[model samples]
Target chain A: MSDQPTPTFISLDDAAAMTEGTRVTFIPGLQALYSEALKNVCFVKGISLTRALHPPMGIDKETGEDRQARLFELTSQTSLPTMFHDDERPRNVWIEQLALAERVGSPSAPALIPDDVAQRVEMFGLCAVILGEDGMVWNMRIMNDGPLSRKYGYNKTASAAAPAKVAEVIALIDARLKTQAENGSAYLVGDAVSAADIYWATMSMCVTATPPDIMPVTAQNQGMLKFFASNAKVPAIAEVLTPRIEEHQHYILKTYCETPAVLGGDPL
Target chain B: MSDQPTPTFISLDDAAAMTEGTRVTFIPGLQALYSEALKNVCFVKGISLTRALHPPMGIDKETGEDRQARLFELTSQTSLPTMFHDDERPRNVWIEQLALAERVGSPSAPALIPDDVAQRVEMFGLCAVILGEDGMVWNMRIMNDGPLSRKYGYNKTASAAAPAKVAEVIALIDARLKTQAENGSAYLVGDAVSAADIYWATMSMCVTATPPDIMPVTAQNQGMLKFFASNAKVPAIAEVLTPRIEEHQHYILKTYCETPAVLGGDPL
Candidate 1:
């Protein structure tokens, strides 16, 4: 690899524009995991089929039906986030989610991702919704057609990550953390911040803001903007959150993840 | 028994009707549960406020402002749901929320909303979502407002229950059920379907058909609802659900819940 790394993505859109694939999911293994802002989840889950595909409902190029048919099918399934059937959980999400379980023997274990082999086994029991659309591909594409979803489009197909699912995921994490939170801890997995916490800190960017240089959105996250624009307390949380978020991004996740190729060089 | 059963409602020129009370919440417990349709949540919620208030927003004398404002405040904590805080969550909603958690018992207890508990207690976690608001005398006022809430125009308040959070809730629940579902158990809760299942079932109303009888409107539920109609799927779910839901006349909740007039003789 060259020392300069020949920065690949000039802009966020440039990365999304590289769409060469038929299906795109949240960056594999990099889904977010926060539990605090459950009340403010609206801000995090701004990505969705409706918001992404607001105006135009296209027709599938394949079956030749209203594109919404598949979109709704996938959207409904996804809306409930059936990423994996109880019997057919997508290995991709299940495997990654399982990584969070208490694993034993694995060197990666005890790194806030679980060290208990039993917990690891139970992860198969954990739900990590899927989005594969010979049925769904069209609607996500339509989301890209919108000015809003297009603004944050991703994957080679430049498909818009369904904001609805994103929010649902945050709520899932929040639900997972309610007990943890009832005890009073901002983090998810372990005593400190776990992969779940780090994940939320990272993914919230799709809805909220990240460093201008990183997420590089022209706007601060959407629903958050609408909220804090009117409400006062939320902005206070942002102030405390934004910088610590950077710390987690740098010190925690940065240790594992690479900069998205769509964005630029290797992980920052 | 008095001849009058169906409660009264207040109307607005711009939107749907409201309950006798000025305050209202279109959340799962109150409106969506009874209606079995998410399309008219805003309107149904509006009915609560209308019935409570002497006048509706922009239409009549202002009476329900306090209720509306407080109800808004309770669910307005962070816009993030207390439960299920994943960043991958969806937007348009149905159910499975955690943000507005109601304290039932121990966190390690595994289950939520035990069947033996009273309705308010069973749904206590969700009901607590309203605690943040002022429910003193207004609780009764809210109770009384049901008839007025169901009449003219409401459906615009927009609860914390967004479309995205609904998706995340379903996905998470689906994930939770993976093992059992694989085991051939169809329900999410116990052998039959508990409040948890009922909540999801009620929330799924977001996907149900909102006939005109329930969501009476000036402009209509949507431009072309025939294509979007949920059909028997919506009613079918209602059949398996608790008897609490009243599809036609909302007086069950209005008289029994809001005012104790037994407008629908809900057997409370």
Candidate 2:
């Protein structure tokens, strides 16, 4: 388990007082790839966090207002993983968080982004493939939504493109692994672990779909997890994911994400 | 210019006759990124092509039939750049075409895919980012549609995400260039020009719109090009296109795309 203090999470209603000096994030998806990734990054860097619940479906229980709408009002986006720090500007998006991990992290918990210019470029490029709109998670979401649409709701034509897009991304990650293997280093960019590694390690769960033991999601969210897991289980896409990636996943969980990522918490 | 013969294109009706021995592609957008890139690949490899027009708007003027529907009947897809060859399965998508370019290309022309496994994987991965549904062109299209929705017609929410997605893709290409600069190579993947180079050189026109003299489009298509250029012109994405990418563009165009890409061609 990471030596960092267990993060104190607050209800959205209680977030006002905590926002004064604390680092806060409006987060959702008790078991989301992006959400878990963000929490893991905080744990690795030993950055204490105050989490404000942005419910998975965007609806908050107390306010009955769409948390996504609230997020958009504050951060101009509905996406999760928005970090608000004291005094300085709010950091949104996965890339910004990676950079923040570097800024706030001590020497012992070094930044995931590499120092080499080329590696940095590679890291950013890889992250874009995973985090960008047409990226792995986005494709995975579409795949999840497509099936769910029949049972719940979706745009069939648009969602039809998800599998191929997801396949393309997984192939890219596999290729990166091949290159890393040739270089005799297991990491994506260079010899050391970088943001690319962290992002992929967590985001890849969109495909591999780990059990609840490590990434603990509530029973309420189990259906959503199945959606993600089934999306990843597509044969063509799943085949592209070599054992090399699973090795990285194991390494990441063992090293940085050993602490169980349980759902829900009390106010600070 | 590539030493290959100037290809003779045909209408959808004429495509049936040439299906026996000739390599054919269901193509649209006279100066379209995918269409032109495919043509350039064939030209470089001395592979003669029989082109069948897939009307950009998906409606055929001559028969008043939905061309996309017609394409789907042939290949189960409406996307352009689908290639039909003699006695083999149809090749669709950019990845398939890249693989085919190697099989059909001559010793003199050579495949655009790199020989190095790592480079090949990178090339495929990068190409996926371009050709995949969420790649640059897809994002550009959405951004174009979003603004055009007020003036023309489009899906607004989908289009809103375009600029950022396009920016992410452009950033990746720029990062590749930076890494190439370090290795003393200008190409996106390896030392030699690969399919990745050709695809970007042409597809990027969707962003950095080339002048009419080189990539001549119909007056009707001019608006589309403008939409793409303006989308690329967004500061976040435009700033990523460094001098290195420009150098490669110049190299690809001077070497492979010297002939003006006029808007339409006569049927053979």
**For residues B1-268, could you state the per-residue lDDT of candidate 2 as single tens digits?**
2222344567654563354644545444346567678877777777766777653444678988875665554543445666766644455556556556666767788567664444554665576567654456766766653432332224677677667767777777887778887999878887788777888888888778676555655544666667766755787777776666667776787677555663453211
Please estimate how well model 1 matches the true structure, expressed as its whole-model Cα lDDT: 0.29
Which whole-number lDDT from 0 to 100 does residue B126 have in model 1? 30
Give per-residue CA lDDT, model 2, range A120-194, as digits (tens): 546666776677544567666766454323322235764787777677777777777888889898777788777
Give stretches of model 1 more than 4 Å off: A1-57, A60-64, A74-82, A87-190, A194-196, A207-243, A255-268, B1-44, B47-257, B261-268
Candidate 2 regions exceeding 4 Å error are A1-8, A13-29, A55-67, A146-154, A265-268, B1-268
DockQ of predictions, in order shown: 0.02, 0.02
Best by TM-score: 2
- For residue B163, model 1's alpha carbon misses the true position, in angstroms, by 32
Q: Pick the candidate with the highest DockQ.
A: 2
